[model samples]
Target: MIEGGALVKNGHIQQQLNQQVPDASDWLALSLLPRLGAGRLKQWHHERRAWPQQWLEALSVPQRHYFLYLRHPQGHGQVLQPMLDWCTAESSRALLHPDHPAWPALLNELPDPPLVLWAWGNLACLEQPAIAIVGSRHPSSAGRHHAQAFARALAEAGSCIVSGMALGIDAQAHEGALSAEGATIAVVGSGLDHTYPRQHRSLQQRILNAGGLLLSEHPPATEARPAFFPRRNRIITGLSRGVLVVEAALRSGSLISARLALEQNRDVFALPGALEASLSAGCHALIRQGATLVTTPTDIIEELGGPWRASSIQGAENRPACREGGERQRAGHDPQAQRWLVLLRDGAVSLDELVLRSGCSVSDTLNALLALELAGQVVMCGNGWTLSAPSSESGAQTR
Candidate 1:
């Protein structure tokens, strides 16, 4: 398997991550090399494998010279040092090698995937189904609402909302997902160490605290730039199954993401606006060009199937948000939550009692409870579980 380093030759690749790795500094150095895009590096690495160390030896004379310059004291370790220090300083901060378990494998579907990802917060979020919501940096009021509402609904439906954490619609999307206690990921242009809008500094912390992720291909301390944002749009689309455009002018970056999504064979969804709304023009044009027209979360959800179609927490508003990221991760996509509720028809029951009633393991019984609790289908009542608010008479629950 390409992921596991067992070559399955259809022009196969082996990821020898566990064998031996280059110095963190060296890997970073390779990434920063001039004229070396991630696409070329990945193709080369897969063609011949020993790890990044060998790749350095294989570089052209000039590339090698530049690599040495990065290591030189005068050449400004400014970019590398802060990035490395941040990763070293915190257990949560990580430079995710392509072979890392937490890497967003969906990105690999892209023509050119990132070599590594600078990730902050729960890496588990990367494995979840994600829908990218992108739009104009200066969206209209309605556009902002659409971005947030759709994001919240999609998140509640168990799809992570992916976006660039910019000033307008992107930020709103992140906030909406947070509001629903749903997972979200921000594929940012700026390095993980700094915020672009600066206004979003607090929003950044809230994402980490809420189990969402902040990701960057750039090293830490790399501030935002106009060119960086567009380059990073590919990553935002690459990580998602679909890209949603809430509102965008013809010239907007959100449109670029949609284009990349199409090129990557990912679904593109657009929320069409009024005939006269300039911001809606991009979305309308996209729809005319065969992008899916989405009016509600259900439209996007039904289009992007799999786990997204699975029964999840009921209403976004009713459920108590998961208090911890780990607990939420474990609770995801558990079809057994409904089955657990059937066993609890008699009334409130302790974990031991539920285990006895359902003839399941203690671990299973506990997991069911957490899922139900998160769904607002059940609540903890004095160390036991019972059905929660708006008591259903039919006793049926959404998956």
Candidate 2:
């Protein structure tokens, strides 16, 4: 079985993906229609539940002809079949339609929510309390460090960090989260099939290995273009409780995401950089425009709180991601401690991850971890806890 977003090898796992969902194909077809862009689609969303019918009914003659063309073999093979195959290509891959339980409901608050989302890796990250860290593709060295530090801090505090998976600040933010063994999500402009920047292929795989997610709106194999990047920022902001600008020039796209966050009524946080630095311009602008100026991860968490806390917005609490856990453990340490030991068998694990993987509440996990530390069974190593010596649970022996 796929343990951590491993791509299907033989291209199997085709039986239950997207085939059973109601109106799934219709939604995918709508997303793929060449002439029907998100702007036009949003215009007909006044009816919400009935918008699909409205979209079908209001299609112009050419649009209707195009839809008909999609039904034929030639158009189906060229435009639709690849996506169909990609969705069923692996158990880790999924086409997240609105009806799919994995679909992020926060996107619905947008004026234009995607009809179908291309999701890879852990779907649970979509529902977790997320904070978006965005900024310039070219940032100062200090800017890069801040991005990584803030992301790592927030992640260790149990928030899923979101970013565009771009160079500079975005890449550092994702890396920081993975280093903490914390959850993260990358919302990219191109299709899931293509990794933009080419060099980020390893970073992408690391994210999935850490139980993170990679998301895209485009169909598989679709190449990136100049226009796709700006549009993808909306999804990045939409997925988070707030947007943090590490470093940005006034005219940069980071400002665009901050503007979108403001428009969506989501919080915007900015870090103050050197006054003479051009990279600090957009953030200064944001602060002047009333975005929160944050210096620590707590500021972001206290301001936005963690996932379980009450949110100013709805839906954050309405639907929690339900995970299927392993069989109950018996003997040795308490059930919570046992789960922790099994997970840390390979190596160290962060407190946030211990809470997440062990299915224990924050207090319980911390208290048990402390007991282990006191008993010399485990020790704090860097940002995570590791076994101090061989143990019955770990099955490791000292020479």
Candidate 3:
């Protein structure tokens, strides 16, 4: 029985070895070196493309030490053997260096692309036309609704929605795309081994089951960290043809994604929001700085000029209009809040400007903006605030 079992195991190993594509295990192993980042490794990979031995010889002592450490730890060939064995065992699930046919073409366009992307699920999704929807973790009701509606429309038109799978806007965007039975990609900061927010576990499973993708540059078992997210944002923008900012404060991470998208030459579309709301300020700022202003998904589709089926306009029509009225009239019910909204009405003004203009203390003005934003009386645009579109009754009242 032992002999028979050994024969079966040996055959399986032989089959795997035969089927294995040229393992860039050597290249990937190089990435594990603490000193080498994507830029440096790319340079090394190109030089090694010809005269491979000479490439290894070109490294400095420190570089050489790191390389040798990965290759044969502590001079134990047996230690190195296990790593290669593990690579071989996991070869089917692994993606190698850039030369592989499965590597995304989009990554090549970036100034710094990952040396190797550890991917799972349908690799073909990488080739699809995609758009990124990103925004605050804590979004207003309007912001959440807008993200979902926009994502649904874009997905129905055959565009894939890409996002960070975060809470608030990111979560709603994914749900919207899925609800429309369209493809979406979640570029997570955490590893595939565990979902970051924990609440989104079911959503993650749904994304996988629905022919969508869940991608991470980080290897499995990696933990979430603040630093990883900023790095991950680049990938989100890198994967998309454009990025849409739903709602974000001035320092929101979504703005970081927007900035990266611009640097990558991806189109940036920001939804216009009231100038007075802190939450909308980041997006408004981007628009003022020349990011395309998008009020509907069609605005985006028209800009892209892609072949997309137009869904019903009902969704667009249902969106809440911006609140209207001078800061004083609107603030009548909330006197302190009215003071802050009045300060924001003169166009996009900074928080500091609001403090100066409102005559209220800094803490008091901030509290007022928060209350006004939740009341849908104001929305943030970029680094400033603005009045929301008023309801018909409110408009009449103003008149």
Candidate 4:
């Protein structure tokens, strides 16, 4: 058995983990071939329900030669084997095909939807109604605040927040959703194994633990580059019902996501910032171009007809209530637990944050957290801690 009580090495589940679906191996192989893009592969997928090997006979002589050359041992080892191993991670990861039930139907609206998606964390999040919040990598303070605020509110109201998991506004948006105990999906440019902006490693782990998801069109271990990021933006917009630009420069990548959203016929929303702020330039331009000018989460929710509402108490307030939960029975009575709990009262707090805020040794803080968990005062959310919902408030006022 694996650490999570999963029998990952035997029976039907093991079989599924070890094997790709019928013709999936061929699809994987074809993806590595030159000149065979997603659109072309999609065409082949619909026209011929067989492996790429079946099409070699129908190709022109030059194409057939190139296809055969790709079957060389070096190519097989370089591409097919790695992807096959990637698919075997079981519950922790998945490679979804268009035929996979877990695949997001919204992606079909893309003119060139990815033929395969490498996903990590909870695949079920794909089924949730999602809203994308994207913006500059170096947003102003107010921009960051607005992004996080809207994300928390919308998430608490039952919309899955989607972003690129980049540094500035994207990270804040993801953090907000996780804090609200709501689903968030990160569409990354790099492979899952090679998370970009390495500083976000802990954040990425937290996202998965919080029941969010990480999606990539790139294969496992692929290095991220400039070209990959723009492609990643499309998926961010494609996955959502609407896109909200908190802040962006006139030439920023966030604008790319908004443009893709509009092309996909998804609602586009932008927050208007001070006219003098350079970060607001792209957003102002977007508003001029007819993107909805959003002042609150409700603006986005109403425009997209999502489940979000303004009055909901998100973050810790939205946690699932238990029989022993309620306001009367206070948590964090002890000095150490109190230190950590205070931070999480507003939102999720990671161990590092607890250590920094509490000024406690890491070991002591971890012990305190474990004790709190045992006492049902705090629960692990993603890579952080949050207050457990009380029994008195069993009926949550969430959408």
Clashing pairs in 2: none
* C-alpha root-mean-square deviation, each candidate: 13.7, 14.2, 11.6, 12.4
The candidate, 1 or 3, that scores higher on TM-score is 1
lDDT of 3 by residue, 1-399 (tens): 112121122343234224223245455555565656677556655555442344445555566555544444343244335434433454334443677787767766777777666665556667778999999999975677678777876887788899999999999899878867788989899766669889999998898778788787766667898898999999899999999999999998999999999999999999988779898799989988999998767788888875553443223222222233533223335445444545555556766777676666543454355445445566656556676775223433543
Candidate 1: tens digits of C-alpha lDDT, residues 1-399: 011112212221123223455545656777888877777777765676566446655676677666655654444355568667888898788988765777677777777887778988888898788999999889875666567767877888888889989989999899889977889999888888888788898999999999999999888778888899888999999888999999999988888899999999999999877788798899999999999998666677777777876345345323222233344333334434456667776687776677787776544454355445545567555446687764345464441
**Residue 319, model 2, lDDT:** 12
What stretches of model 3 exceed 4 Å from their correct place? 1-22, 43-48, 72-93, 307-399
Cα error of candidate 4 at position 246, Å: 0.4
Best of the candidates, lDDT: 1
Clashing pairs in 1: 5-15, 311-399, 312-399
lDDT of each: 0.74, 0.73, 0.69, 0.72
> Which 10 consecutive positions of candidate 3 have the poorest summed lDDT?
1-10
Q: What lDDT tens digits, residue by residue, belong to model 4 across residues 1-399? A: 112121222243234334333345544555555665677656665675344334554454555444443444455566577776876866678888787788899987788888788899998899889999999999765566567767876887789999999999999899879867899999999988997899999999999999999999888879999999988888999998899999999999989889999999999999887778788899999999999998766667666663555444323232222112222222234343444455667767876777788776553454455445544566655446677775112212210
Candidate 4 stretches with Cα past 4 Å from truth are 1-22, 46-78, 306-399
lDDT of 2 by residue, 316-370 (tens): 1111111226332222334445555666778877767877887776534543554
Error of 3 at 289 (Å): 1.0
Please give the lDDT score for candidate 3. Answer: 0.69
lDDT of 3 at 178: 85
Model 1 clashes, total count: 3
